[model samples]
Target: MRQSDKKASFIELGKFLSQFSEKGNHLNPEVKNNDRFFDNFVSLIELSQSHNGWFTPEQVYFSVQSWAEALTESNLDQWLSRYDFTNITSKTVGLILAGNIPLVGFHDFLSVLISGHKVLVKTSSNDQKLLPFLAEYLISVTPEIASYITFTDGKLENFDAVIATGSNNTARYFEYYFKDKPSIIRKNRNSVAVLNGKETKEDLVNLGEDIFRYFGLGCRNVSKLFLPKDYDFKLFFEAMYEYGDIIHYEKYANNYDYNKAVFLMSRFELLDNEFMTLKEDTSYASPISSVFYEYYDSADTLKTRLEADKDQLQCIVSNAVITDSIPFGKTQHPELWDYADNVDTLDFLIKI
Candidate 1:
């Protein structure tokens, strides 16, 4: 299939996704193949939590809507305009997707195909349903796309290159196993927010969205906060109050109770707001239901530190106070060009 064909198929898939939301699912008769796929898609979203407790309907709907906005014709064209696919040869790129959040690895899947390559996907068990369902929708829209996609339940073979997302431990295994083959092996990285004690209550409340979205499972979610020395917690906690309903989710509440009990038992000081806890720590990866915070004395020194530790971070959220920092709540709303791990996936694919 031509590149234009692939792009058009994705655009249709996006329109199909735009119909489903937290408010309700509306049937758009103009959307192609909706009569066959729409009802099943809704059923899958409702059944998502049964497969993975974290895949609640609200979270899944948010992810679906995010993709709906991303796969527009203009966005796809802008993202691909810089690449030259004239001399490309189709190679089967293997994808080992991570399922921490809904459609966490969809970008890689899109990159492989959109770059004039076939994709052999190994879906993460936690996210098997959603992507495959969408893949079916894409095939329905463009039958030729079927030849370009494959899913496997066993070991991956007959692939020229691979892109694998996993923990730091699995990264080592991927490096050793795929050493001879060109690959992009991703490791765990966390996002952090920098507060200069000058942010508005609205900014901090939006930061709550960055923290609570996907229950903080995504790499883009801000798991830690960098606050100025002696920064008051009064306003921060109050801003976070908007998301107090998050505690009502049984799984999140269980995590809150368990982690809080463990913290208390360890005699550690914590700033608790019933729904979430803030702890003083130097780590980037915080557990669910809690956020780790650290105090910095100087913006210059903190910038230097964060720059040196860039490899361990996914995003740095700020009000543009820090270099290359994303806005408060926009971490999860990454554009097509916001390459993960700061590695250009399309560049890697085209060269291979």
Candidate 2:
């Protein structure tokens, strides 16, 4: 298919996705594949929790809404404007997706296809349903797309290059396994927030969204905080109270109980609000239902530290308090140009 055709199909896919949301959902009759895809997608959204307990309709819909806003023609055109696709070849790109939150690997899948390459996807077992269902919708809208997309359950084979996402351990294996192929192998990276004591209640409240969205399962979710020395967390805790109900979920509550117990047994000081725990620790990758924090005396020193550990970070949320840091609550709803790990995926795909 031509690049224009590929872009048009994704823009339509975006419109189809725009119908579903956390508060409301409606199928637009004008959408090309709605006759067959509408009802089935609603069923899949309902069945998503059964497939993976984390894929609740609210979270799934949020993911859908984010993608819907992102895949617009304007966004696609602006994001792709820097690339020249004239030299692109129709090579097959193997995609080993991650099932962390919803559609975590969709960007890579889109990148390969939009660059005029075939995509051979191996869906993460945790996220097997949603992407394939959408792929079917895409093929329905643009029949030519059926020739460009494939989902495989077996080991990936016969692909010129690969994009894989996994934990650090799996990354080591991917490094050795795809040694010869042009590839993007992602590892576990977490986002962190740098907070000054001057933050207003609303700033801290929005920060809660950064922490609790996706139940802190996504790499973009803020798992840690850097507080100014002697900063009181009373306001921060008060603001985060809005998300206190997250503890009602079995998985999050289980993690809260387990991690809190482990911390208690280790005699670490913890600040608990009956739902989430705040601990003074240096780790960037905190467990669910908990956020680790560290006190810094100097912003310059901390900025230097963050720069030194950039590879361990997916985002740095602040009031632009640190260089290149994103504003609070914007981490999860990244723009198309916000490449993960600062690696330009489109550049990788085009070159390969």
Candidate 3:
């Protein structure tokens, strides 16, 4: 397919989702009058926030678009002709889902289905609803895909590839269990940001979305901040605090209380207001104890330091100089070209 065709298809899908968003069909019902698919997704994600359950409706949406465009771009039928899909008619792929963040498994789910592989999905209880709902949606679009999709609570063997996501601890389990099979075993990773004083206030506000959206529970959330030493926290906090209404959510408040209590018990100092808290920490992932805001004496030094840790970072939300190849601003204003983990998952699917 031509790139233009690929983009058009994605925009079409985005329009469908936009319609869902507009009608508030995707929000949780108990929150008010929630819709079916998206509302269930949001609730599942909100639940996952407490248990660290993986899969959010938003992440699922992102993954869905990623796969949708990928299939469009690769022209699955044409690409599969090269691999001779007829020869692989009996393959079943097992996906071991993760609950670290919301809807991390949907990408693998899309990969399996779009590639004509029967998927035996072992969903994390934290995210049980949306994938099935999405599978049902796909079935509505093309029922043939339905016969290829199945959800299971138990383990299965003999698959072409196993796409398993878990913590570093369970990674060994995945490797040992799925030994001798093709697999993409993912472990924990976090995203970060580097700020140059030149960033506009408007950009900082959007960066606030990059950080505060989902209350910083997403893999794509900016868990850490790289700032010039002595930089004022006023603007950053102001923009972030604007989203303070999120604190009213009982789930977020619970997390804030647990995290804050832990910090107090540890004797960790924190800066705060009624809405949000801040602190300096070397860790990339925050515990809600406080936002981990780091400082560099200069932008050049910050850039160099980030380079050393580039492999460990997933999406860097930056407003400063970067290797021109790297897209800026959290890539949250995501385009079809942006794939998570900096890896083109669809490329893997077409090859598989």
Alpha-carbon TM-score of each model against the true structure: 0.99, 0.99, 0.76
Query: What are the per-residue Cα lDDT tens digits for candidate 1 across 57-97?
Result: 99999999999999999999999998888889999999999
Candidate 2 residue lDDT tens string, 1-352 = 7999999999999999999887887878888878788888888998899999899888999999999999999999999999999998789999999999999999988988999999999999999999998899889889989999998999999999999999999999999999999999999999999998999999999999999999999999999999998998889989999998898889888989999999999999999999889998888988888899999989999999999999999999998789888888788889998988899999998888
- How does each model score on lDDT? 0.95, 0.92, 0.61
CA RMSD of each candidate after superposition:
0.7, 0.8, 6.2
Ordered by TM-score, highest first, the candidates read: 1, 2, 3
lDDT for residue 281 in candidate 3, whole number 0-100: 89
Flag the better candidate by TM-score, 2 or 3: 2
lDDT of 2 at 286: 86
Stretches of candidate 1 exceeding 4 Å from the true structure = none
What lDDT score goes with residue 348 in model 1?
Answer: 96
Q: Sorted by lDDT, highest first, which candidate order results?
A: 1, 2, 3
